[model samples]
Target: MRNTPLIEAFKENEQDLIRFLIVRLKSAFAAQDLAQELYLRVCGLDESFAVRNGRAYLFRMASNLAIDHLRREARQAELRDELQTFFGDEAEVATPEEALISRNELERLERAMAELPPLSRRIFYLSRFEQKSQREIAALVGLSPTAVFKHLRRVIDYLAAVRDT
Candidate 1:
């Protein structure tokens, strides 16, 4: 099979393109993935589209992808900060017995979480921490809503059992 024009351009400029991406993305691995995505995007272009400078076109695509990555990372950081502000603080004053009970309860919850299956734990976090609906978690995790509900139910039951004992 013959190489497409896009592939040929990519082969010629792969190293320089990756170096440019790394400068913007700040991670070699992420730059490599972005470079591969750029290649796929360029491959989708019609052959009739005229490109006077293939290297310049590739650089522009890489730059745009890097910008998108930065914006997504910034949004995630902002969300994390907001979540901390909302849930980080509680009433500071407590009796010694109350504090001891809180600590023990926290330890039990941690152990309960640790005992969960990997997918079950992820589903719990997506539901509680991210506050996603069951339908949303199903779509994100590629499970049926029923399955998500079951996993969540399992988590609740486990935690309740931990609390009782």
Candidate 2:
């Protein structure tokens, strides 16, 4: 407690840290969240930890957090794109007939999914709806990641064929 210079440094540079994160993250809301996270991390550090420069350490942590946030966002976007590509485009507006056709297709797709083996269906659900990575699904199902991907591909191909007809 007597030698916690990092806390003093953090108090002096808190606003500057927020501004720095905002520039890196491009959102004031995200920046504020990251700043709060940074503070929590600093608070968790051992009291006897040595640091030559606390401000530098804080800014570096902020930068790394921003990068990690961006990476997670990118991964989510990729997942969305994968699903969008699989399901095809969505029309913002649709006529009654078109809506009915889409609903029918959705029902058919659901039926086709039900026809799949339980493991394949589970993998598909985990990957698509849960937004889990293939490795994560594999770990859950006790299969290799490659096997999980194969399951997803098989189900997707089957669903596509069913949707076409």
Candidate 3:
């Protein structure tokens, strides 16, 4: 019923929603694509939609979008692999191990970040990488300073876990 709350909730989860889709879809470029798709779906939502839990509905839309993406990727990869096999003689050489390693690490970070509960991950990224202060990020993302600090601690713990791997 409250458009203000709906908009606020949507904005708060937007980054993580995009991140989740992009990571699963394996292309940050697709982030915009998926976001647009989500908006298209959400725009059609109605009165009953307004009354139910907004976050769950939004995520259900996201989850369905993700499924479609995964199916498309599977089909594309299969066709690409087959095409590459037939064109093996013209195929590019493999990337260097270091390059591959760096790529893997980037993907790993994305995956790890994606694993985090959305709000925690958002605040953590904004603090560490975006260089936002706790107060600034809290104001922007609708969290308290204490919540931001807790998120930072959780991020540190998660990074330590990744390093241990």
Candidate 4:
């Protein structure tokens, strides 16, 4: 690095870096915020200016922090979108509020089903929802009654996955 003052280095690189951040972040305000955060970080370091790639380092830190922020925001947006999409998927006269609750319960059941193990899923589908007996499930799956009971026990473990915790 040259004898350039850190504040000057910050000023010189700020616009280009903010533009880079804006391209990825899709907002002028967010780019400006991240760029300022980068400048502050560089100012806060205790080490002397001896970097081989100062610009790269500043951009790398900003990108990582920005990505973390975006990921958090995206996850929140996904949850909100999920709520919106499922809020009115059933019959009218069911009431839109009732429809929303029904849809959410069905989604919860679907998530629980997805989390089930293969044998547990089979046993569950065969027994409860499909109205098959444990003996019939055992016969179809080629397991004994006792083993079927064991499989059912494991299947109940999936119920915990459905719970909110």
Best by lDDT: 2
Q: Which ten residues in a row have the lowest lDDT in candidate 4?
A: 1-10
Q: Write the per-residue lDDT of candidate 2 for residues 119-140, one digit (tens) a residue.
A: 9999999887766789889899
Report residue 31 deviation for candidate 3 (angstroms). Answer: 2.3
lDDT of each: 0.87, 0.88, 0.76, 0.76
lDDT (Cα, tens digit) per residue for candidate 4, span 1-165: 333455566677888888888998999998888888877777776556556667777778878867866865776787778876876575247778989988997888788888777888898877765556678789999998788888887777657656553
Better of 2 and 4 by TM-score: 2
Question: For residues 54-142, could you state the per-residue lDDT of candidate 1 as single tens digits?
Answer: 88888998998898787667768989889778767663567899999999999989988998999999999988766677998999999
Structure candidate 1, residue pairs in collision: none
125: Cα error in model 3, Å: 42
The segments of candidate 2 whose C-alpha lies over 4 angstroms from its true place after superposition are 1-3, 90-165
Candidate 2, residue 78: CA error in Å?
Answer: 1.0
Clashes of each: 0, 0, 0, 0
- Tell me the deviation in Å of residue 96 in model 3: 42
Candidate 3 per-residue lDDT, tens place, 62-147, comes to 87777767766776788789988977859665579867987888888788988989888888878765556799898999988998
| Weakest lDDT window of 10 consecutive positions for candidate 2 | 1-10
